[model samples]
Target: MKAFFSALSTLTVLPVPRRFHQCDEKSLAASVVYFPVVGLFVGVLLVGLLYFLKAIFPPLVLAAVLLFVLVMLTGALHLDGVADLADGLGAGGAPERMLAVMKESQVGAFGVIALVLVLLLKFSLFFEIIDKGRWLDFVLMTLLSRWAMALAAFLGKYPRVAGTGLAFIGKISLA
Candidate 1:
């Protein structure tokens, strides 16, 4: 009877207990969830804004709105990554030194150029789809781009820090 009660109690509760870390598991999970929500909102908002632009201005205006929306939605986090990674990789140093370069807050020419190109490409591609008069394309692009970001963390090694990135994703699972 006691064993039955114990099993019932375990099954009734949360399966994965919350964990705390320098970066807590719950907080990280929340961030992961939050990004997609923001992306969805951004995607919808951009499409609507583009629709408005199509009425009031040129199609090129849609690209500007989309670029601005991305900056707003990500708080430019991935843009920061692009900048950091560019500088680090472009430094032409050993791995340790390269990682150290990336850790610095200073932005360099390569970083700026990389960020500009990334934003440009995203905006241009998004603009093309929007111009085709398809609203569903916006939602699909948002899902695909965000999923690609999530995969980026999985496919790469933990740069210089331990326990960084989609906290719940395991190396073997990704492999």
Candidate 2:
């Protein structure tokens, strides 16, 4: 379906049906419905990579590689968000100031610290998961996280009137 392809293309770098490449209002709206499906595709790819390298590397290395691959595959979009949010939370005093901080492109000290901690946490958690041979958990967790993103986009308010999220948020089923 156009929706699925659009969703897959938008959510990840993975190739999808050619028709869905040019994203638009309708496609984005439809794509929200397929967010979890996109997550599944991403999860499967990560799982396959893990299995291929499982025997060839140690747990820490594998975890690092996995994290790196995830960042690459998703274009490090989440990291940017986390950094901005952390900076806003730490440095911004008033609500207006927080909004301004989040809007700025440059990352602050709080953002840097937060990213470091998050990366460390991700690496440790991933190391443990791979060590225990819980591949299924990895996939399920990936799926759940993506689903949560979709839910938030659908349910969360878009703070800016004109931004990338504006097209996808508040344009679909909000009930």
Candidate 3:
């Protein structure tokens, strides 16, 4: 239970007791298992927000608000990853140089472009899904994307000797 709570706390902006955020081998392991579960919770919240606001706001306004809520709720964790990955890929040098670029706190041209394209894709996709009346598709896709994050963690190697991702680098399993 503590592990699940830890995962929820780490993944969402939902108020979690500070004590539950403690990092330990046990909680780290449990958090991976709960990663998708966190996404499911997020997706449900998004779906609810969409329906509630759909009747009150124009589609464009609602889409903007929905995007804001998601980015805020998740604290842009995945967005940060996208930016880092973009920097690493776009650095166009030795692997170490790319890694260093990713580690840098500043966003590069590639990072900005990547983030913009991703957000634009999301915005247009949301518009189409709403037009087609496919709310369930949105929720399911959200769940699937988060699950992919867990998969990536399981398969990924740590770029640096130590960092936030080290916790999951060699310490994950499908089970």
Candidate 4:
């Protein structure tokens, strides 16, 4: 039971290879399914925060607060990955070059643009939800986005040069 919950916990965030060393490719795919569940928690928290502030503030302000909370909670990990991916894709280089660009620590113009756009979109979506006073969409988006991230990772070829994600790839099964 404990193990089940632990595995479920990791699936919500980026899975660390160190913790799931024994997971084979097949189980990896199965494990990936839980990310949406993780998103539920994220959405719940955000909604709860919004709810608490609803009496004191407007939806727009609550939306901003929730967004800030999300960034802090997730540590902006996915946003960073999105930025890195945008930088790599925008480089107009070979796959190897693109991979290299992604590996770099610095954020480029593409990364900046991507981050801004994604944040804006997310903020707008959340604002809409808050405006309507619906929490369901918030939870759904969180889960769907994580699932989308996992799908993107699963479908794409793993870039060469081992990193944190490489081990995750090895453990992940495509099913």
> What lDDT is obtained when candidate 4 is compared to the true structure?
0.73
Candidate 2 vs candidate 4, lDDT winner: 2
lDDT of 3 at 24: 77
Backbone clash total, candidate 1: 0
- Model 3: per-residue Cα lDDT over 1-175, one tens digit each: 6777777877888998867666776567668778788888888888899889888988777777778888899899889889988988998789999888898999999999999999998888887777677888767877888788778778887768888878866688766
Ranking by lDDT: 2, 3, 4, 1
Query: TM-scores for all candidates?
Result: 0.69, 0.92, 0.92, 0.79
Residues 76-139, model 4: lDDT tens digits = 8778889999999999778889988998999999999999999999789878998987888888
Q: Rate the local accuracy (lDDT) of all candidates.
A: 0.61, 0.84, 0.82, 0.73
- lDDT tens digits, residue span 4-50, model 1: 22222222221332332123454443344233444465567667777
Model 3 spans with C-alpha error above 4 angstroms: none
TM-score of 1: 0.69
| Alpha-carbon RMSD, each predicted model | 9.6, 1.7, 1.5, 3.9
Give every collision pair in model 4: 25-173
